[model samples]
Structure formats: structure tokens, C-alpha cells
Target chain A: MIKKLRIMIGTNKKNILALTFIFSSLLVLASTQFPPWDVPVEANDLENPITVDKKNLDAGKAFFDLSCKACHGATGLGDGAVPSGDFTTKAFTGQTDGAIFWKIQQGRGLMPSFKAVQETSLWQAITYIRTLAAPQEIVAMKNATIVIEFDESNSKKLITAKVYETLENGEQAPAKEVKVNFFIKRYFADMLIGGSNNYTDDNGSVSISFPEGVPGKEGKLQVMAKLDDSGFNPAGLTEEVAWGVEKAAYWNDDRQLWKNNDFVPLWLLISFFGVIGGILIAILYVLLQVVKIRKLGVGR
Target chain B: MSAETTDIQKTGRSLKEITSDLLNPIRSKKSSVSLWTMLLVFIIIIGVYAYIYQTMTGLGVTAMRDYTSWGMYIGHFVFLVAVSLVGSLVTAILKLLEIKWAAPITRIAEIIAVAAVALAAITIVLDMGRPDRVLNIFLHGRIQSPIVWDVTVVNMYLLISVILLYLPMIPDIAIMRDTLTDRPKWQRKMYKVLALNWRGTDEQWRLLKRSIRIMLIVIMPVAFAIHTVTSWLFAVNSRAGWDSTIFGPYFVAGAFMVGAAAVIAAMYIFWATKPAYKKYITSKHFDMMGRLLVLTGLVYLYFNVNEYLVPGFKMQKLDGQHLMDLFVGHEAPLFWATQIGGLILPVFLLCFKKFRKPLPIFIISIFVIFFAWTKRLLIVIPTLLTPTFPIQNVPESWHHYIPTYYEIAITSMTVALVLLIITWFTKYFPIIPIWEMAKENGHDNPHEKVVLDDIEKD
Candidate 1:
């Protein structure tokens, strides 16, 4: 059986050992340093007293902003402006609600104890903390489909788009009065192709016409309609059509430090090399003198 | 009066008496290892074991984390480099300025410098999480990085210190080669090899003096560079408490203060242990060093005030929290103690002539060294903890750094290792320059006199 296991794992002993070493290292890294902190048996066994409903969530959020936002950040992502204990870890979230309440009541190190806060309020805060799982942007967008359609009946080159809300039965109905943007896509970013006063009408549709000679490949035009709303993922739909003259790619010679182009200022280049090069050369010269002196000794 | 004539008219110890007196430490039977040495060795063993444990377990064994990345190790490194600069200050700078009284103290400074710089190098490596990747620094070093500058200056400082330690010891080594012919075969061979076959020819002496002069001139800037670049490792960062123009001079001033204190501490230890060299290291030397310490202390005090006061007064938004922590918050106790006890109190003590005596000076130096070490800890840790924005997702323990037992052990090991280096060096070497003392006392080497005259004429 041992021989069969060896054959299944690796033929060579060294290879098997290397694989074991790598796998064990990964296991160690995956494990958190936070061992289970001691909690009172009462606290450990107790369930959160407050019901987790919308009212409790709002209450929890109010308290969280009041007490914890400075350190725990708005979303409880441990990115507070003030230095404090990170509550975003599995080690933190894995604890029972009572244990968290106890910890908050009796703070350690940089974390302040919230003993004055009522137990029900603390429970509400814990509920808010729990709600901070990754935001539901993608899921919300998937449930709302946006469609763009083009009509050029009068050769006016008009484009129309619509937003539809998906029902529980997987059926779609028109969504009304939602703002939409029509834009032509560019290399660095999308260029808005329509006016700012654009939105879906009561019928859930937007109509706009193409502007002059926006160039693309082989006189092809690419335009998109996007649903722009705060706290929601932007749902976009794009359409391609042969409409305008083709334009060759052009270069922008703007100088920026992050772009890695060799457009550094002359004085900066001179000063950097002059100072660092001078110091290095001076140090090197001194070292070389030591070598010369060592050579002057009785024996080489 | 010419130097040679004045030496003849001075407190005349004959050449033979000087030679025998200076060489007694080296030629005598090796002193049995003291209990202190044994204790140091034991601590070093434990430290090595702890290091092995740390390497196996990773840096998690230490209390350091993303926020407070550096801990006691970097603090200890700063202390080592600070003390090591005394070698340049005493030996090279004083010798170049032609200070006659500094001769007996020069070797002590050089040995301390050698040991401390060596330890500084080792301690910095110990600070690295993956020390094996240290070679990658040289292989893929960015010239613009402050770390590269630190490495460059530190290595240069080490090389210069070692050479400076060796150059003046050549004549003394020759004395050992000739005098200790009756010693063990291995020791005799070792002395012979290290002595560089000095026949005491006039030409050789001239060349030696010229080399020593060149090294002295070159080493001053290198010494200053080593510590300045080290300070820049923090100062170059935009972090509060570190983002000041005064750090370079501030660090240099503080280094000289602690360096002088270290030399005083060593002087007391050596003077108390070995009575044979009582004539060589006298109370007069202690008085001079005490006065020098007071000057450095005052300068360091001025810089310390400038370092803190300007920021505290302006209360710039970035530095406000850090200054508050240092001034009145959790860090205030250590901060105030370091300033008052380490910098201000030493100056106060050294100001009185009565305290400039050897024993009082030694005790004061102990306080200085201790406080200086803690001061470095304050410099490295509090600023790191008070960074403007907090690093996310780390355990709260990352907010405040308290070095673990492993860190304490490794730091203690480096300290003990430096002492061990000094111990072995004192055991094997003369610790005082026999020929130089003899020459200074007007036991004229006729050959050297001719060479000196010729060089002066040319």
C-alpha cells in the first residue's frame, strides 16, 4: 500500500518531499493566527436578543456610524481613518453575537470599550456588521436587463434604448423614468455622444441621434447606452453599425510620470544624477584609496 | 617647542618601561573567562536557538506586523551604529587634529567601533523576514531606494572602520610579534602573519603615516554618511515625527553623544579590570571624554527640541496625532524619560567637575547608553504606529508593537556578540599602541626621525 501511495503521489522521494513541503506551507498560510479567545460560558451560549429586521438594521447602522465609523470604516471593511482593531476577518465574524457584544463592551488595546451602549443597541450594531457582506451590485444588475435599439427610417440615424425589470416569474416589464447615457467608446474612456438631458420616458425608452463622422474601423460606428444610478451596477448595451468615415489611429504625446515615457525635465535629470553620482563616485574613490594603501604593505 | 623635544621634557617613562607596560596585556597569561562572559555566551546560545525558531516559524514570532513593521531590531541597529561612530570621532578625527592626549583612548574607540559596526550589520540582517533574499538586494537593487543608500553607506563604513582599526595597530602588532616569541606556537604564528613583517624602516613608517593620514581624512565623511543615510531611511518617508530637515544633523549629534558615552563605559570597564594599564588610561582621559559628551549632549538636546517643538507648535494635520502621542499620550513616559534622562540629564551631570571623574562619568555613561537605546525605540516604533492612515484587515495587535521574547533574545544576542568580539579582541591584542606610546614619550626611533625630517622638508 505504501508503494502504491508513493506511485500515486510521486516516483521520486525528493519530489514527494517537495510537494509535501509546498502543500504544508499553503495550509499554514491559509490558517489564521487568531485562536479562539476565551468568552464567558453565559456569553458564549447566549443568542442575539434583537430580531434581525429592516428596523433593527437601520438602528444598527445609526449606532455604527455614531460609534464605530471612525475606526471600523463605513462598510466595516477595517479601513477606518483612525487606527483600531480589524473586525473584517473570519476570526472576528466567526464569533457568536454574544462574544462580539462582550468584546465591544470590554475593549482591549486601541479599541475603545462601548460599555455605555445598551445591549440591544450593541446587538443592532452586530446585525449591521453582518449585513456588510460584499455589496449586491452584480446581482442587482443581472435582475434588470437594458436593451438598445437603433432606427434610421428618416436617415436621421436615431438610437433608442429601453430598461426592463425582471419579475420572479422570469418575465420582463418596462422600467420607467430611469436615466440613461448614450456614448461612443474611445480608447481610454467612453465619450458621451448625446446631451446631458437624456432619460428613459414613461414608456421606458430613450431616443437619440448620432452626431457627425465619429470615426471607427471601416466607417463603422460603435455606440452604447448605459443606466447610470448610484449604489447600482451600470448596465450597458452597445451597438455597431457602418455609418461614418474611417479614421487612422493618432498618438497623444502628453508627458506623464506613470506612463514610463522618456519626457523627464532636464533639470530634474541633471540634479538626480549629479547628486547621487557625485556621492557614489566620492565613496568609491575613498574605497579605492584603501585598496591602494593595502597594496603598499610589506606583503601583497 | 618641537613635539620631539617636548616629549623628552615630559613625564619621562623610558622606552623599555613603556614597551613592557603596553605589551603586558598581550604577553601575560590569558585571563580565565569571567562569569559575565559565560553568561553572555549562554544568552548568545539561547538567542541563536530563538533565531532558528524564528526562521522556522516566520516573523510572526515577533510582535511586528504591517503597521508597526520595524521593532526592537531596527532600534538596536541604530544604537549600534550610534556607538560605532565613536571610532571615527576619537581615532581618525582626533588623530588628524593632532590631539596628543587622545592616543591611549584611540585603540579603545577603534575596537568598540569594530564590534558595534559588525553587530549593526548583523542586526539589520536579523530584521529582515527572509534573510536569504538579502542577496536579492544586490542583484536587483533600486538605486533610488533609501535602503540601497543605507546598505551602501553602512558597508563603506564597515570597511573603513576595519581598515582604520588595523592601520594604527600595525606597529603594535609588530611589537607583539617580537615580544611574544615565547608564547604558544599558534599565537606566535598568528602574530607573525598579522604583523605584516614590520622591520621599522624609515620608508615604511613614512608610508604608514601617509596612509593613516589619508584614511583619517576619508573616514570622517564616511562615518557621517553611514548614520545620516540610516536616519534617511525614516526621514525620507513622509511620515510624521520623521519628516524633518533636522534628522541628519540630529542623528549625527546623537550618535556622537552615545558614541562618546560608549567609549567612557568601555574605559571604565577596562580601567577597573586591568590595573596594568592604569598609567595608559587615566582619569584625565575620562574628564576629556566627559566634557566632549556634555557638548554632544547639548547639541543633541537642541536638535531634539527642534525635532519636536516645530511640529508641536504648528500641529500640522498629519503630524498632530503623532505629536500628541509622544507629548502626552501613551508614549509620553518613554519619550520624556529618553529626552530628560538620556540627553538632558547627562549634560547636567557632566557640567559639574566632580561628576567628570572616572567612576561618576562611567555611571552616567551607563544611563546615557540605556536611555539612548530606548530613545531609538521611541523613534522607530511610535512614528510607525501613528501613520496617517491605518493598514486594514490586520489584527489589532498590529497597532501597537511590543517585541516578543524571541525578538528580545535576538537583540540581546547581538549585544552579547558585540561584547564577545570586544572581549576576544582585548584578550589577543595589545589594546594600547606600544611603539606609538614609546615614540610619543621621546624614545626616539632614529630611523623615524630621519624620515619625518625628510617628509617635512619635501
Candidate 2:
């Protein structure tokens, strides 16, 4: 009977563990679940009026970055702080331009509606989102190179990029009118240095005076020049330069009141312990006197 | 020798008579006292039940939410801490200044101090959502935090107050051990054990006096530190109502005011109820305590003007909002009532010789003590309600705070606990120090000199 009771208790323990596991899993799942959202049928059939071009995509990308990127993520992977629609997914991309537009215009639950946004800007945002669905082919220049140089002849620091393409006869020729973009690499993302008007001249180079007050490690910055036009293979050159403002040392080991117990300010430690210790000794002395009084009573 | 003999004749009662008079309340079993004890016990039981329910459920049982996080419990804590300062004021400060009249009232103040500080410590735990994690405070205490400082000084204050209470009571306890032969065997044993086997030796008296003297001096700063640290718990935060440079002295001043009032209230209750106590706690004591109250109240009034008027003159945006709420807004009634009725009128009325009488001053003290509590709540709640940023996205109930019934019940339990402790101390032992009264009546050694044969006959 005792063995039977032991077996029943063992089974009960297992049952309780299993129940706890199931309950915890349900709680986790319930917390992560998003409420369902629906769009009107008429809204789903509307077409996007804006064409997908470099200029329009650029405008849309700027707007998306300012607003939607915090929720929808940089590459639209729905992996932002707030869970949002992944534009790369068929679940999102298969929806008509009108459905996506309607969702953006009329938000649900945690999602905020963009009713105050301009109509043209909304279409431009849609045009840029379509490019996130899949990768596209790029035609490459067989032998091409880009060089970044710091030109200080004009008193101000200028970052100049020269683009070159090798001809059939193996001669390097200036690749004129080739759109180039210059950027300074930062921790999270590259910051554009030269504006969108950057294009190679007949000398195969474009120049932009370096901006001031950009913080860098030890005053050195990583400058990159990339080919921006669509018909070329992905290419860019990165060079470490000394154009950025020097970053001061951010952290120090000085003692502070806010520091942990090990590193409390020296003066505070002394005063705190000194006052408390003095009082404690006084208290101990009084307690000892009481003990003496008790002993004196015993002797008497 | 002539002066001492004349002083003894002034009381017109022998040392033996004084001892028995003081010890009579302990021997008498009054039905009214039993009923009062029962009522306090009933309230304590209900409070304990509510506390258990709160711990079982959570702090959610209280009306406190995210915005008004430190609600009624914290207000009670501040009030208790403030009231506990009475011990140092009556026993240490007055004794050090050689004020002879305050000697009879010291034990009453010490009892209030011990009870208030003990409840103040418990009230902090009651405010915690997780009372079980209270040990984490000592395990990982940061010295720089105002909270750790508060806990340290409060514990120190409690220890010192208890010692002050106990050291003076040893001779009296010895008196009970020897003279109260008809008490229960357990009661006799308790008195004997707690008496430290005193035979009233000169050396024992010497040590007792020395220890009490040391405690009297040490308790003053520890008492000051306790309330000052409690004030820092608010002043360290950059809240509108609490941000002040003079908060330390301001709190100390306010503490003395309320502490004096609390002592006066206790004095009146004892004087009115126990006929034997009237000779010791006389209208003279009431008149003296009333004057002390008025003095503290005026000092507090000075700090009050500095606290409010300077800020009111500037009327900085946040400070203005906070001041406006107190001056002419929703909280104006409580604010004005606490200031005018509690502080101003009590101070104003107590200044007069007629109003300084026992019955009148006691009534005023009741108002003062009650309004002092409301003043603490006003200091805590309104500032919390007026946040630096607008309070948004919470439930409508979060906007205003009215303590739930459970909170009120739990708070009332602390009050009952204080009263119950005082009642037990008075019932089981003499509240007034017999030896001190005899000494005051010019007996150098009251315990040895006074004949106890008649005490047994009585």
C-alpha cells in the first residue's frame, strides 16, 4: 500500500509539472498574439499611382525612415521594438497597393492611422515598399574602381570621389555622369555626406566639402563612396579619414554618490561611517554600563 | 540638607506614599480599562485580517497605483516618525536644559516614541507590494540612498527610545518585584527578571543614572537624524511640494509641534482617567506642555511661511500649480484646515492663559494631532497627483486618490497597536517613574529610604 501511494504521488508530481508548463506556455502565447485587422474590399482594389523610380523611392524611403521604420523595421522584417507588418512577406506584398495604403491610412489597435499624411507622399511610400519584396539583378562594369581623396586646397576640407571604368583596350577612362554617393559610416547606419546631386564630371570625380562637428573615434572617420545608379554592380570603397571632430572620453572611474557600495564618494564614506560609528560606540558603552549595573546587583 | 528637607515637606507626602500612589493603577483592575483594551484588540484583529488579505492578494488591495505610489501608508509613516520625536523633546532636550517639570512626562513621551517608531517601521513594510523581500534592504543596502539612511536612523531611534524607557523603569520594576506580592506568579516573575535584581545599591544607581544620562544625550541627535532622514525621503526627490533647502529643519520643527501635541493628548487622557495620576500630571503640566506646543507651532509656522510664501512669490510653473492646489484648488479645504485650525488656531488659542488649561488644551491637541496627520497626507498625496509631466493613459480612478477601506482599516490597526502597547505598559507596570517622583520630592534614595511595610498593607 505504501509503494502504491509512492507511485501515485510520483504521478501527481508529474501531472502538476505538466499542468504548470502548459499554463505558462499559454500565457506566453496569449501575450504575443496580435489582434486581427481587416481592410475594406473597395480599399484593397485601388492601384498605386506613383511609379517606382530612384527619385520617388528615395522620397518614400525618407518618409518611411522618419515614421514607419520605428515599427516596421529598417528592412521591413517586422523585427522592430513594436511588431509590425513585414513588407517582404507574401502576406503583406500579395495585398494590393490599395490594401496597404488603406491600412496605413486607417490604422487598427496599436497601429496609428496616417490620415494627416499627404496623398502623394503616401503613394511614394508604397512605391518604395514594393522594392523590399525581392532582390533585383544589377549589370556590372567589368573593371571599375572608385577612389576617395581629401582635398584641402580650398581651405575647407573637401572629400572627393573619382570613378573610373576600363575600356576594351585596357585604358582607364573617366566614367562621367556616373551617379556617386558619399557617406560616413556610423554605428547604426551610414550617414549620407554629399547630397543626391552627386554625379561624376568629365574628370570622373565629384567633390563635397566635409561637414563639421560630426563625432568620431579619435577624430578618425570611415568615409565611403558608392555607385548610386541602378545599372551597375554593388560597389563602394571605404577609407578611414581624419575629418570628424574628436570624441572626448565618455566614462571615468572617479568615485560618485551614485556609484555602488565599493566606489562610494570618499568624503561621504568617511562622514557616514564616522557619525554612525561614534553613535554605535556610545550605545555599546551604555549597554555595557547596564550589564555592570546588573552585575553590581548580583554582587550585592 | 535644610533645603532638601523643605522640598520633601513641600509635597506634604512621604516617599512611601508617592511610590504607592504611582503603583496603584497597576494593581486596580478597572472594567472601563478592560473594555477599552477589548475595543483596541478588536480593531487590531480586523486590521490584521485586512493585512493578511492584502498580503495574500497584493498591494493592489490598496488604492495606490502607479501615479500615487506612496499613498496612505507613506503618509502614516511620516506622521508616525514625526510623532516619535516627542521622546527626545520631553526626555532628552528638556532634561539636558534642566527643565524639572518635564521629568514626570518623560515616560509618556518615551512610550509614544517606541510605539510610533515601531509602527513607522512596520508601515513601510505594509506599503511594500512584496513584504517578503524586506530582507533585501539589509542584504544589498546602499549607504547613499535616503531610504537606507532612514531605516538605519529609525532603528537606532527605536533602540535608544526602548533603552531610555527601560533604564529608568528598573528601580520601579524592582519596587514591583518586592512590594507587589499579590500579583500573579508570572507577573511577579516578569518584574523580578526585568528588574535586573536591583537592591538599590549606590553603584547600581550610579550606573543606571550614567546610562540614562548617556542615552539622554545620544538620543537627541539620533532622534533628529530619524526625522531628518525621513524628510530626505521626500526632499531628495525633486517634487514640487517637497523640493526645499530647509526641509531638514522644517521637518524637525513640525515633528516637535505634533510630538508635543501628542504628549499633551496622552497626558490629558491619563490625567482624566486615572484619579491617582492627577497629582503628578496636573493642570500645571498641561499648561507647560501647551506653552511648549505653542512655541513649536510658531517655529513650524515660520518654516511654513518660508516653505510656501517664497515659492508662492516666485510662482514657478510647477510650484505654482502645486501651491494653487493647496491655496485655492481641490485640496484647498484640507490645506486650510490643517494650517489654520491645526497650526494657527491651536497656536493662537494655546498662547492664552485660559485656553492653556487641561480640558481646553486637550481638545485643541486632539485637533492639532488629527490635522497633523491630514497635513502629512496633504504633503504626500497632492504633490504626487501633480506630476512634472501630465498624468496620462491611466484609469480614471488613478487621477484622484481616496484611500480604500482596506487601507484605512490597515492604517487604523497601527493606531490601535500604539494604544494597545501604551495600555499594556501602563496596566502591567507603573507609567510614572516612582523613583524620579520621590527624588523630585527630595528623597536621595527613595527605594531604600522609603518603608515598604505599609505598601503591602495597602
Candidate 3:
């Protein structure tokens, strides 16, 4: 009967072990299955306006190195720290430029939205991503200049920048289709102020509304406009504006609990030293009594 | 006092017999004792080797990483600190309460306390990755830190415990110096110097008693402070398991329970190994200790209920996760085992008279002590696992804590060192106070009486 019971117990143990193994495997499979990201139909139908060239590809590569390389891998093989989807796959290359642009513009889960990135830069990044699947050749551009002007009318703050190109005979003409990005100069990186889709019109001028509530040092903000088109040399113009709230410096050096040891609260110090001193004195008295006991023993 | 004195005198042996019986363990050398000592020394040597390797390599050798940084070493430190409280419990608190039965076991408790606390100090150093730069704590020490307070109180308690152990042993040392003439010259001289020329004169007795009375009172707060400050090391943190106002009292109560179990375990060992110890440390002592364990166990149980149930009921997000881990998650088995086997069952079993017998209670005490160590680990590690922020960016192995062999070796070394110190003390000094036992048998000055008896014999 004991041997029969032992055999039954062994079978039960095996069954339980098998069940646990199967359950853990199922859990792992379920965790790896992520939901599919949905993109709007209109965003998928949008067309890429920027030309795929060496200059634009380099600019795209710079942005990809800064943000996407950490999660998407250096060569886009999905071998990065977080292990993203392989960009070199036919599944990835099969997607339309418009679909990829929408995915980048509207990220899901671990992917972050690139909505704040300038439209030209986003298109340039897409151009560089094409090379991750297969390498491409280089190209060059001509030089151009930009001039900026600020206007405050009907309580609306506006900034306009005019783009022009110099001909070989020294004649100047409007530089149409040039991308002009408006920014506020701040510590670290420049804060992008206008919408991402700013482009020069037939008159070679683009106007953008300056945003409200920008914090500046003593109400002075350096507004800058730059022409960073792949077809021309980059040029910039800066103008100081008082359309910012004055940033106040805050300082606190009070003697509080969180302060350093030099500024320890008085009550804590008193209580700490008071209690420690009282106990030490009593211990000292006890030690002194031991000495007296030794003396008494010796006197005898 | 007179009635009790007469009662004890009925079954009491002569003062001379009392002295010899209590001191016999020191005089006789047993092979088993030597074997035990050798075993402890061997383990300590392994621990030292592991520690050297750890220092040469780095803490990377241990499983401690970004998370679960405080592992078995800190847990062992808490255990030592907890066990060390038995010193103040039996030696000071019982002595102050005028509990006469505790006199024989005071030395045992004091020895355990001294060894445990001393090793506790050492264990903290072992936990440090840079054991060499330990002086940075002193060189740049700030009074605002709980660590500084812990250092201060632990050192003070060590000093007071040593004095408490020494002051009571003076009369015994003097007896050893005069009577143990066949002992090695260095041993005799060592006793002579330590005895401080203790002649058991009325004046010397007066000074000795006065000093002991002062220490017995003084040690209470320092003892409380040591463990309370130690508790603050955890309670001061805002972690779910450790963040509680009652942790100070909770820890103190638990310390008392664990310390009581340690004393019983030691009592049984002495009673079993040294046949002479059976005469002095009887079943009656075990029975009393069992009752004390029941009392401390109940108090600790009360704190444990408050510590867990209140938080468990509310089940705040982080606290809920932490409590669930302890109650039904990965840690539940060890947690339940500690609560039931270590605590609830022992407390319940010890209440009955049959289980309070030497053999049964000794077994129970062993379970209690073992669980108590694991209980400390539970208190430390589980809360760390349920950190406020999710554990990310590290390897999956870093999520859990399983102590490496090197860590285990170092921790075992601390335990072995405590046992070795206790064993060495038992080998040299009387495990029970010779003079105190004689005094209980109605001799006013047992030390002088032994000298007089010697002169008469000569």
C-alpha cells in the first residue's frame, strides 16, 4: 500500500510540473503579443513633398542618431537596447512613405510622437531611413540668405522672414519653396516657436505667430528665423523681443530640517546632544564606581 | 527574601560544592568541546578566505546589485542585534526586577550579548564594498544621520555589556585565581589582574554592588537605544513594510522573544554537554524561560499583527503589492513558515507544561531562532522588492535576491564567530556565577568563605 501511494505521489508531481511549465510558456507568449497600431486613412494618403537627396539624408541621419537610434538600433536591425521592429525587413520597406510619416508623427506605446519636429526635418529623416534598407549617393546645394522682421498688431505677435537668392551676375531674386523655421534662443537648445510647416511663398516671405507665455531672462527673448533648406546654404536672423514673462530667480537658505548639517534645527541638536550627554554621564558614573570598587578591594 | 533563602537552603549543597560544580566545566577539557571549537575555527577560516576574495574582486561576486542591495549580511546583522538583546533582558532587566531564578543564567546571557553585538559591528563592515574606507563614516560623520546614531549606540551598548559581564565575574575570577593553582601561569596571572584584588571585603562588596546597581539601571536605556536606533535604520525609510510608527516597540518586543529563545538554547546545551551544568541549570530554569518565551512571543505576535494586518486591510497600492508578495506571492511560503513555525506554533506549544521540558523547548527554541533570522530577512528584502518605481533597465535576475555563496560564507562566519566566543568563554569562566550561586545558598561572602575553607584544608 505504501509503494502504491508513493507511485501515485510521483505521478501527481509529474503532472503538476508539466502543468506549471505549460502555464509559464503561455504567459510568455501572451506578453510578447502586442496590439497593432492604427493610423488614420487621411494620414496614410498624405504625400512626401521633400526630395530624397544626400544633404536631406544626412540631416535625417543626424535626427535619427539623436532620438531613434537608442531603441531602433544603429543599423535599424532591431538589435538595440529595447529591441524594436527590424527596419531592413521587406515588411517595413513595403510600407508607403505617407504611412511611415504618419507612424512617426503619431507614435504608439514605446514609440514617441515626433509632432514637434519641423516638417522638413521629419521628411529628411524619412529620406535617411530609406538608406538603412539600401545605401544611396550624395548631392550638393547653392547658397541663400534670410532676413527677419517682428510685428505686433491687434494684440497678435507675428514674425516674418524673407528668403532671397543671389544670381551669378549679383542680381537677387525670391527663393520660393524655402523652409524657414522660427525659434526662441534659450539655454541648451533653441525652443521651436512656430508650426512645423513654414515655407516661403511666391514673395519669398513666410509669417508665423509668436506663442504666448514664453519665460525669458528679464522679459527679453531672442527670436531667430533660419532657412535650413537642403537646396541652399543655411542662413539665420535674430531679433530681441519683449513678448516674454520675466523669469524670477528663487533662493531659499533657511535653517530647516532638510538643510545641511551646518544648518541643523536648534531643537533637534539640543534633544540629540541632551539625551546622548545624559546617557554618557550615567555610563561614566558607572565606570567611576567600578574604579572605586577596585580601590576598596586594594585598600583591604 | 528570608523565606526564599530558607526554602533554597533545604536542597542546597555546601558553598564549596556549589563553587566546584559551577567551575567544573572550566577545569575539565572535553573532546567534543575541542571538536566543536575546531569546527567553528574551520568555518571562520573559510569565511575569512571568502571575505578576502570579495575584497580582491568586488561585491560583484555577491548577488547584490542595484536592487536588493542589502542582502543576507544585513539580515544577519539584525539577527545578531536581536539576539544580543538577551544580555540586557536576563542580566539587567531580570536582575532589576529581583527575579532570583535568573542569577545563574546572567553570565550566559551577557556572553551571548557581548559576542553577538561585537559580531554585529563587524557584520556591518563586511557588508561594505569598501571595507577599508570605513573610517570615512567617522571622518565625515554627521550627527543628523541615523547611521551615526546606530554607530554610537552599538558601541556604547558593547561597552556597557562588557562591563556588565566583567563586574559580576570579578568575584568568580578571584576564586579562580586563588583556587585553580594547577592552571597555566599566564591564565592564573590573567585572572589575578582581572579580579582587581577582589577580597570579598564588606567595603569591596559594597562598592561592587553599588556599581552593578548603577549599570543595571544605566544599561536599560542604552540597550533600548541600540535596538531602537537599529529599527530606525528601517523605520526611518518610507518603504511600505518598514514605514511604521510602532516599529521601535515592535522590534524591541521581537528582540526580547528571540533573545529568550537563544538563552534557552544555550541553557539546554550547557545542561546536556556538561553534566555538572545539569545540577545548577535544571529543568526549572527551562520551564521559567519557556514561560518568558511565551510572554515575549505573545507581545511580538501583537506587534506582528499590527505591522501586517493594519497595512494589509488598507492595501494602499505599493503596500498592497508588498503585502501580497509576503502573503500569497513568491515570498509567501517562507513568510508563512516564519509566522507559523517560528512564531505562532512555538508560542502556542511553549504554553503547555509538557512542551516546556528541556528537550522539547530546546527544539522549539531552535526553530524560533532560525525563523527569527529569516523573519529579519523578510522584513528587509520584500519591501525593497516592491519599490515605488517599477524595476526597469536591469537584467531579470536583478529583480530577485538569492544570496551568493560568498555572501553566505561571510554571514556564516559571523554566526560561527559568536558561537566560538561563547564556547571560549564557557571553557575558561564559570558558565554560572560561583559567588552568586553560593550567596543564594545563604553564604554572605562566598569568595571569602572559599578562601577560608582553603586555609583550613591547608
Rank all candidate structures by their DockQ, best first, as comma-separated numbers. 2, 3, 1
Give lDDT tens digits, candidate 3, residues B1-458. Answer: 23433454576766567777887876775535477888898778767766875776577667776678888988888889999999999999999999999999999999999999999999999999899999988787677788988988888899889999999899889888877888878889999889887787777777788889888888898889899999999999999899999999999999999999999999999899888778789889999999999999999999999999999999999999999999999999999999999999999999899999999999999999999999999998988888889986455567899887778878988999999999888878998998888877666533444443542354
- Per-prediction tally of clashes: 0, 0, 0
**Candidate 3 per-residue C-alpha lDDT over A99-199 given as tens digits, one digit per residue, 9 for 90 to 100:** 89998877664466777788888888887777677652233355677888889999998899998987668888988877788999987889987875688
Model 2 residue B432 CA deviation (Å) reads 1.0
lDDT of 1 by residue, A1-300 (tens): 345444434532333244433433333333333444698989877899888665576567668867888777866777775444566677777789889888888776556667776889999888777766533421233346788887777769888888886676999887666667788877887788788557678887888887867778788878888775322344788888776668544424554332322554455457546755665665466446445444555552
Which parts of model 2 are misplaced by more than 4 Å? A1-251, B1-11, B29-33, B445-458
lDDT by candidate, in order shown: 0.77, 0.83, 0.83
lDDT of 2 by residue, B1-458 (tens): 23444456676666667777898888775536578888998777767766765776577667787689999999999999999999999999998898999888999999999999999999999998789999988889988888998888898899889999999999889888888888889999999899887877778878888888999999998999999989999999999999989999999999999999999999999999888888888889999999999999999999999999999999999999999999999999999999999999999999899999999999999999999999999989999998999985444677788897678878999999999999998988788888778777766534443423333444
Top candidate by DockQ: 2
The true-versus-predicted C-alpha distance at residue B279 of model 2, in Å, is: 1.3
Error of 3 at B230 (Å): 1.4
lDDT of 1 by residue, B344-403 (tens): 888998999999999999999999999999999999999898877765544467767888
Clashing pairs in 3: none
Q: lDDT, candidate 3, residue B229?
A: 91
Docking class of 2: incorrect
Off by over 4 Å in 3: A1-253, B1-11, B29-33, B445-458
